[model samples]
Target: MYINSSETAIIALLEKIKSLEEPDSAGIFYNAFIVILDAFVQPFSITILVSLVVLLVLLFFSAMVSGSEIGFFSLGPQHLEKLKQSTSGRGKLILKLLERPKRLLATILIANNFVNVAIVILSTFIASQWFNLSSFPVLAFIVQVVVITALILLLGEILPKMYASVYPVRFSKSMAGVLNVLIKMFYPLSSILVRSTSFLDNRVARKSHVLSRSELSD
Candidate 1:
């Protein structure tokens, strides 16, 4: 009876091992684990998270810079004097920077363009990293444009400008140093843009200044 009972226990252990090694049983267990992991784990990695945060920060600053243009230029003579008298270093700095309109315009334009380019590149990287965007070629391009454009248009351009218009003096004062540094950084490019715009303006003025032939209309 003891020998018979020992044999029965050994047979049960062998049967358990065979069941575990069966193809259908192993496949079911493997697939179930995969499903559980998929359900619980988020796909984003640290680098992806960092990139998104940086992208948002860049967009916010870009919008502010774009709005500063309107805010700085729109100040009337009376408001300008008030800013000049104010003790805030930023207010004084704003007046000084505004003295050279061409330089200011060029700097703002260059900086804004740089920020926008960065936004586009970063956005593309995110889309590729997160969504494997290249797989859907047309959709990738469209998604990139629509997402970036909406952010830039709504946050970077329209809202900032509207806010600046409402508080031009305050906005200019706050952004004075930032604009100054950006201007200095891109001075060469800013000067070139100023020269080109001046040339274009003079050319148009000369054409418009020319008189029609007396024989025809004069």
Candidate 2:
């Protein structure tokens, strides 16, 4: 009786191993896992790339505005040096530029509009001949424009600006070197642009004042 029972247990163990070794079942499970992995990974990869691109574009604009405004303010060397030492100093510089929030916002809006329009025109021309759909392509293009614009404004502009505002000092300090290099490189052109703008504004104001004076006299 004991030998019979031992043989029965061995037979059950062998059957379990055989079932696990079956090629069809194992292959099906393996393929299912692969499909699941691909489904999960592909969208995530695209999302990450898109986010990174948007963030970089926003940062570039933020840096440009920060550099130009910091140039305009003309802080003393001592304060500037101290700012360079602080944490998030680069972000801080950006926030400081936002002191005139309206102007900074206007600059960003104008820059975004210019870039998006150029991109749309180029994309439309390139895609026009590829697709034969009458109105679908145009509708798709409009949708793409809206989605990209919203993504840029939200992920690129609002989020980064908010984060920089929260930790300006640290951000500015961290990016100080990079910002300094960029500012220096673009200084000549930025100077020319800023000065020209100021000159034009002053002229307009003067003309407005002169017209008001003449009207008052009459």
Candidate 3:
């Protein structure tokens, strides 16, 4: 067996590369294990605790904004009459908000989306602090999809909307002040969205009318 100098050099290089990779691979596994261990053992930090509190607060606001959508929009003839007769400031605000339905809907949607995004970001931050979510795909999916979605659906969407629908007038009045401020604050965004939707509606109506006329002629 005759081996050349180049072959010897290649073998040495391969050996060195394998030696380097072995430690790196071990280090990665070791670090991941340590992270999993600490997730169970360590107490949450003050920052994490505070973020969790903020997350809960955001969820509360999410519930309020989501409820307001049903509350204001579900107001019936009777509900309007109540607001019309009431001397309360909130009733006045509710009436004012309803005066512009498109803008009101836009504001509610924008606020809901903004709060939901904040909830996700804060939740991710808290989870990352506690565990290496990237290392556990199943757990990550459960937390991000199942747990978070359930929380939003149950607390932020379903329950509030149910309550609002059942007591539209009361819910509308209770949420009116906050929504009044939000409508002003989000006016620019809501206005743009309202205009865009109106334009789309007009275009769709014209297209439908043209189709109907064509069908009649045929």
Candidate 4:
């Protein structure tokens, strides 16, 4: 009746270990993997449910941000001309963002990283709750590194970008509203990154030009 937080946690871990010990519809390795994946399959409480939901939403946003990079950048000169002539507010916003391409790219990179980090954090929390992942270092590493990396690569990066590339304007227009908000929110950081990269690029260009001139002299 007087179970403290530690005791509760211990009890939960014990239950998870007990579940792992039970026979399932699969073999040892598969069952172990399933045990680690229990967070997705079993939602025993509202907190886990909410975490799962938020994790999914973050993943979706990650996909959107990743896709937006391809969507906006792949726009051709003709597409940009169309954007300039278009009366739609979203098209106007897209043109505005493209005016400062470095800043816009920085904003998308920052937002994508933020969303992906959140997804990893929320996923870790959910996994920890469902299983004593710490007890299995290798399994934990697999789940955390390999599995999550694959998910982010496939779901957050590749698939969305593929779609975006095929329908660049539509994807960019769809993401215009979200991108506008993110550009403002991340303006400070994005600007700093833009300035730093610009400075580095100029330095590199100068160095390359000097090397070329020296080669000509020789």
Evaluate model 3: give its TM-score. Answer: 0.79
Worst 10 residues of 1 by lDDT: 1-10
Query: For residues 1-218, what per-residue lDDT tens digits would candidate 2 score against the true structure?
Result: 44443344445544545566555766656655654343222333554555456545654564444433333334445555566566754645654653643344345345445555554454443333332223355665664576556655565456655665655445444544554555455555556656677789899999999999999999
Off by over 4 Å in 2: 1-135, 208-218
lDDT of each: 0.81, 0.51, 0.83, 0.84
Sliding window of 10 residues with minimal summed lDDT for model 4: 34-43
Tell me how far candidate 2 lies from the true structure as C-alpha RMSD in angstroms.
16.1
Order of candidates by lDDT, top first?
Answer: 4, 3, 1, 2
Give candidate 4's TM-score: 0.79
Which parts of model 1 have CA positions greater than 4 angstroms off? 1-42, 212-217
Model 4 misplaced regions, further than 4 Å: 1-43
Cα deviation at 2, candidate 2, in Å, is 80
- List the candidates ranked by TM-score, beginning with the highest: 4, 3, 1, 2
Give a tens-digit lDDT track for model 1, residues 24-87.
7666566555543343333889989999999999999998899999999999998988987789
TM-scores vs. true structure, each candidate: 0.76, 0.42, 0.79, 0.79
